[model samples]
Target: LVPPDILKKMYVLRRILNPMGTVDAIEFLLGKLRETKVNAEFFEKMNT
Candidate 1:
């Protein structure tokens, strides 16, 4: 297992190595833990 500090660094390094507009889930989780703000809107239209 990697220490959180070191693991975070690893994630950054991995992203630097391959930043092809793909998501890096680990970074997303880290951001969430840090209380990153996210906004979403949803609309549903149905006729019954």
Candidate 2:
């Protein structure tokens, strides 16, 4: 059980380490989802 603060910092570190940030990953995933006719509820639930 990681604290939210630690999780936030980890997310920041991950973004720093990743050449492409989470937004890019989200966009790529969203594109793939579009091709698969993903549900609207899934999009609504997506944090991005």
Give the whole-model CA lDDT for all candidates, comma-separated.
Answer: 0.45, 0.58
Q: Candidate 1, residues 1-48: lDDT per residue as tens digits?
A: 865655566566556547534457566545544552432110011111
User: Pairing residues by index, what is the TM-score of model 1?
Assistant: 0.38
Residue 30 lDDT in model 1? 52
TM-score, one value per model: 0.38, 0.39
Off by over 4 Å in 1: 20-48
Residue-level lDDT of model 2, residues 1-48, one tens digit each, is 975755665576456447867788677656656765555443344453
- Index of the highest-lDDT prediction: 2
RMSD values, in order shown: 13.8, 8.6
Error of 1 at 45 (Å): 53
When summed lDDT is taken over every stretch of 10 residues in candidate 2, the lowest stretch is 39-48
